[model samples]
Target chain A: MFSRRLAFFLVSLIALLLAVVAPAAAQESVTLDFYFPEATANNAQGIFEEYAAQFSEAHPNITINVVYQGSYTDNRTIIQTQTAAGEGPDVAVMLSTDLLSFIEAGTVVPVQQFVDSTEGGADYVADFFDAFLLNSVDENGQLWSIPFQRSTPILYYNADLFSEAGIEAAPANRDELVAAATALTAEGRSGLWFPSEGFPIWLFTAFQIAGGEPLVAERFDQVFFNTTATAEGLQYLLDLSKVHQVMPEGALSWGDGPTIFASGQAAMLVHTTGSLTRILSEAPFEVGTAFLPFGPAGEDGTGYGAPTGGGNLYIFANSSPEEQAAAWEWVQFLSSPEIQADWTARTGYIAARESAWATDTLTALVAEKPQYAVARDQLAFAGKEFTAFRSIDIQNVINTTLSSVIAGDVTDIPAALEAAQAQIDSLLAE
Target chain B: MQAALPVTNRSVSPARKPWSQRLLPYLMIAPTFLIVFLFTLKPAVSAVIDSTLKPARLAQDPPAFVGLQNYADLFNPTHHLGARFGGILLNTVLFAFGTVAIGMPLALGFALLINRRLPLRGVWRFGFVYPSLLPLIGAASIWAFIYADQVGLLAAILRAANPNWLGSPGLVLGAVIVVNVWSQTGYYMLLFLAGLQGIPRDLYEAAALDGANYWQQLLRLTLPLLRRTTLFVLTVSFTFAFQAVELLQGLTEGGPGDRSNLILYFIYQNIGERRNWGHINAITIILAVIVLVFTLSSFLFFERGGRESER
Candidate 1:
């Protein structure tokens, strides 16, 4: 009986050892952690998880772990804290505007290095839209991030309200914009709403670009806020509310603007194209989409621009080479034409790659819901968003000044712009 | 037998003792010491060191030692810091004191009422404490909806006025203060209730026998006895009020020309947006000094009160 028990124990122990060694002998695998912010509108997390699962199925030797971090700001905070402690996710989706900061912290590796080493690298790099590439590449021509989910500000108007007010079509220029807004303002509803609370500067950048003045220089050092064109743009925005009385009296929050527009409190709303899907489903009235109206200085129809807004995928420097390679594969898979087209159809975000728009899936989607095509067309005139040496500081200064000016508190537009310019200059000097 | 025991109690100087024997006490404390050192002391020291350096873009340029330059820039009127510092400080002070001034009395009244015999006393206590249990962010969101311009509860209730509670610069801070008071009063009431319960009932009975009215007894006995509790509650409330970030982030975001801006929000903006760690650490150090002074002064006042009571 003792001899039989000893043989049974040996057999069981050998079986346990084989169970552990079989997987290791079969194939080597790497598991990567991909962090992204929770989308405020669409069911982004579920779609992202599906993408990860699909990617894992395609590459059976590699695994992708999706972590839905909080908001963009919260994600940045987590990345900063984790990287400072010498550990962070293998890859993350961060704001394109924060690319400079990420590069500065030495936390992210340049995408060019990975792209150059990967198969079909040149074609992959060329697939992305040139407008979105502006924020991805630095002055030295180093590619730091790949555009994932991108958006541009667009005009959303109530077509029913416009017709009721006898407006023929959406506004094409500043003059028509003001006229349409004036006609739309009636017993209870305001005609226009531009949020001043969050990312006000993004909308203001659109205005500046439309007015024929880019806010910052190419070197990301100097700002042109003190220019006459910029002041005109600021005055135009302020006049919508203070002079034309076509908007709410005081400051309107970004979080509230969508609800107000959907509820028909405002006839027109200037917001990110990411809201297209949400607004379409929620608005009680017939929703019409159009490109932002060109400023007075812009050419009749061609010289208009809006800043690109959205997040990009970045690989961390602290990750192992194997992990980084796996992360690159995951990114490429996620940004492929088929996936990008599907993502665009689900979320209102524009496909980051030009080829994604040409995909049969996306073409069919655009035919079904043509509103998605307007934002893609506007990408032709899209410019670089406000990014500088200290982009956030510069943005805050401009946003604060714009908020005060729009609220009718700062009557002197040029003075306010000058103060903002000085602030940005000092930050750049630092 | 004693000799055969081999002198196990041999006298050895502590300096010559075994390493484990010498280190046992330190070993027992090492875990806590390491935690405090890593978390608290290390960051405090690093903040000081970071404050004295010239601000540099992290990866491109290394920071140089520039003593007091950050502090100087913060005070220079030509800079952004100098332009907004005074107003932010004033707003913080107003927010902290405004909540305390209005909230303490309301809490005291509720505590006094709940102390008396009433129907469903347990239910009344829970109802009084419910607001305190709600998360600040949730409360802020609710208040934001209430303060909305067109469809808000306030707009519906005050049909003629249509006050823009959070949008108007003049009224935004007051609106925030009202939310803070509403959320915090229950907590303070609980503290006051505990203090009220600790007071002996015989004292109130003796005062009644002496023909003292309820008002006189409360003024002379309850108020004097609750001094310690008041001090604690005030300090806690002041600290929390000064660090009001979640509510501001959720509701107003320090907008309408920075009318409702506080120092904590300013620090957060600097860290999250600006990435100017040197400036952030400088501001943090200054805030720490202010908090230290406030806490010390309160403790000193409490000590003096204790001494007087002893006399």
Candidate 2:
């Protein structure tokens, strides 16, 4: 009886071993090194890991190793450094505008390549918002990256401050913004604070979009900084702080803008929609979101526009074919309507695809907190983020132009901008 | 304990060493020499080469020689880059001068105060050096709060009279200087303390016997004795001021729009933000040359002073 029992135990153990080993032998396993940055999203790393686990569970052969890089720039640096050493992550989420940089470096495989190879390619590409896709294109107009944590600059206002000041609604037009800001202005709190420090080009670009005309057009080499609309926008911004004294007189920090509003130091703040969850959760009083206030630029004399800003998923060219295929699947999984809905619910990033909004996850989220839909609605008016060949250099030129004018270091705005335009052109001409 | 002793290759001959043995000194220094070559000399030479080339915008683009175009672009004058570059240099110079002018004297004063026997003299010395011992980031955060807008210690104290210390371009350089001075004074003070100790006690005694008062002895004895140390401190502080990237990064980030921008921070920005390697290398070479010239001149002056004093 003891021999029979021992023999049965050995048979069962063999069966279990076979069960584990059979699948291992039948299919090849792939491991992917995925690099991501810690943008202002809540628990982004945790959420990403959870998704990776879910994907791996569905596809047992593929395993993803998620590495959290520092900032978006740091992510690019890591990829470059690693690529130089013949080692790089299989996938990374870099700035959407950085598509050009990666494309120029030949480090990233265009998602279109995979999209074309996959089923429902046309519909899948079309599902993403046009505003986001604006920055996803390369010099040849190929969709090089897929938008992930897409965002737009929006007005985050304090409802309590609005009530206290007896303002009716969130500002829409330039006059309304000015009037509302003037009303909300107080001893400590400014009427409205726009962050203009440490890369103010984003803020300026948002304003310029509303003011009409992007800094750059369809061509990577072209720039339109010295336009009348740009001057009007600059004058208005200057007048708000310099002449009206409604906003603070110096460069406000993007890092501090949300916190300042949440802490009631600023009545209203102009910051990214990505900051929504943070601002909403942190504010003691009611918080509201709205489209960025328009300027008198469009045919209707009021144009509401903001540039989309965020990261995009790009599969590395250096990755193996199988890894690239797996990375592409991972990208699709993340950007799928269902996953994007869950993503939008977890973090306040605007859902990259319009279809994501219709999903139950986002439907319930939006219904529960209507403020979550503001950026999505405002996406209709959003434009391309500033991206060019050697974009960062051009951006610095524009940023310094804006900052110096604010700092009173440059007295001539038009001349400074014109010189910047010439400089930018010359930089591209080389 | 060896059963039998044997002379190995290490102790083979007194007349001539083996090749490996002969190469001992060079072998020992190989790592150091390689490190210096790889990190310092190679990069410096590459920077010079890079500065002369029109940078490849794309990594795959062929390297093209632009002669001194990269260097000239910095001072092109068409764009405000040249002007901006000039402004950055001026700001750095002012920063260096300000730190040296204010920091050295303050350091000397603290050293003098704690040098003499007083109650809890160790405590005073410790207090003076404590800030220097604290990490730069920590000191930066503390001062950031002090200089923070709307809700800061200075804001509370001045009651709305406090200007935007870190924000206002007019006052930002001064504000950064103050923070640098606060953190650096202690370090210079320690040097001063060493110099003070080196001065013979008999000199002060002799001056005292001659009926010199405390202030007079300080002027006639301590000041003259500390001239070398003082010069060293000034030169060191000035050189240090040029290397003030962390404080600027932590404090103002070379802003309210380039108000507090110094040379090192500008180079940092070029590398990190602009990614214009050619521009970065050019700026680096220029700043290095400036500091090198200043340092060499100061070294000569110090050497001359030492020689004349000896005579």
Candidate 3:
């Protein structure tokens, strides 16, 4: 009996040792916490989860835990708080505009670091669209993030309305646009709708760029809102509503613009490419897509530019080395040409990488759905979104000025622009 | 004998206790005090400290002591915030007073109606209080749809005029105030109902015996007796009005160009958008001081009135 008891104790001890040692002897497994905002569409989350599952299956030793953060704004807050508390996710899809904030907080490592250490680094970096890469890089030419879901502001018109108004085609220049809009404004319908709320600066930037005035300096420390081009551009926007009566009387809401256009209240709508799928599915009339109208600078000129807008994948510096490596793998997987093509097919966001457009799926999709090609074509005229140190405050000042200008509350465009520039300068100085 | 004698003496001199015995009550309260200090007092004190420092842009740069510069900047007309502070403050005051002035009487009327013997009293009470149960953002969204131009329910009903409820700068605050009143009246009504229940039945009977009409009784007896409840309701509603953010965020977003911007929303924007912690904390301190002064003055006034009544 004593001998049997001794054997039993020895066997139990061996089993415990094996339990602790076997996993350590095997390859190291990493689990990464991936955070992304909940997409507006229902299937987006499901698609992302499936992608994550596929990634995990291919890389058996790595696990990707996907968490649905709230909207883009909410994700900003959550990431800030969580990272400050040293509990940020390994990977997150953060706003491209928030790159500076994350960098200033010392919470994110540049994507260049990870890419350089990996295979096919140069080719991978070169694959992204130049417009997107412009926003992703800093002053020193360091790539801070990888573009994921990107978009550009494009013109969505009612072709049937244009035909009724005796317009031959979508406007290619400012003069043509105004003429078309004037003709379209009859009976109960408005000529055009430009969203004046929720990132008004994005659409406004297109106008400013078209007028041959970049709103801010490359370093973001200086703004030229009081310039002739800026004032002229802003005045033109105001004339569309207050003077020409081609648009809504007061501040038109960004959220309501799509709905209004879908209901045929507006002949033309200016919005992001992200809304293409929704508009196509919802619009009662045949939806037409066009590049935003060029100003004096013309199509090939520096004046005609639309800001590239959307979120990008960022790896947190707080993550462990293993976790960071695993996250980079997942990021590369998600950003591959095939996956990007699939993503573009599922959602209307522009494919971030040029190679993604070359994929058979995307080529076929653009053939079937020609509207998808407009945003891609517009990329040639795309510029960086307004981003700088304290960008939100600067953007708010410009947005407020734009709002007042559009509302006819601030009639003097020069004065409004001067005030906004002063404010932005002060913000940047601080 | 010795033990019995000591016990009797201990009972006679219970005040002369051991250290543990003396500290028992304090020890029992230590946990709660610690929690309060950590959650409430710590943040409040830190915010006060933060208000005195310059906002740090980079992690490498430690926050520098800026003295009263942030506060001064708030009033400096050359600065963007400095120019807007006056209007924002005025809006906040108007919002508070408007909500109270409109909300209190409506709530009192609701309380009086429900307190009396009536038909479907339960259903009516539930209906009246239902808005309070809905989340602020949810209610604001619903109101947004209702207030939407052209296609909204308001436009549908009032076919003659298409009023931009939230878009019009002049009408936006009043529209928001109406929504606030709708949400809070039910809560204040419940409070007034409790206050009314506490009032003696004989007071109304005595007023009736004196040939007082409903208005006279309400103005004289009910109003005087419900002063404490009204004070409480006013203070709470004032704080709620001052801290209004969800409605502004959901419906108007402080637009048609900062016409409806409130102090709390301003502070929130500073934090979330601008990351100007020092400036935000300064504004927070200003708001706190204003709320404190208002509350304390009201208390003092009430206390003086009570003393006069005693006299």
Highest TM-score, which number? Answer: 3
Q: In lDDT terms, how accurate is model 1?
A: 0.83
Candidates in order have lDDT scores of: 0.83, 0.82, 0.82
Give the range where candidate 3 chain A is weakest over 10 consecutive residues by summed lDDT. Answer: A296-305
TM-score for each prediction? Answer: 0.91, 0.88, 0.93
Clashing pairs in 2: none
Better-scoring candidate (lDDT), 1 or 3:
1
| Model 3: per-residue Cα lDDT over B1-311, one tens digit each | 54564455555556777566889999999999999999999999999999988756776678889999989988886676776677788999999999999999999999999999999999999999999999999889898888876567896798437776776667878989998998889999999999999999999999899999999999988888888888899889998888899988788887777777799987766565434777788899999999998888888887678678657
Superposition error at A84 for model 2 (Å): 4.4
True contacts kept of each: 0.42, 0.35, 0.35
Best-fitting candidate, measured by DockQ?
3
Best by lDDT: 1
**Per-residue lDDT of B80-101 in model 2, one digit per residue for the tens?**
3564688898999999989998
DockQ values for all predictions? 0.45, 0.35, 0.48
Q: Is candidate 1 or candidate 2 better by DockQ?
A: 1
Location of the lowest summed lDDT over 10 successive residues in candidate 2 chain A: A294-303
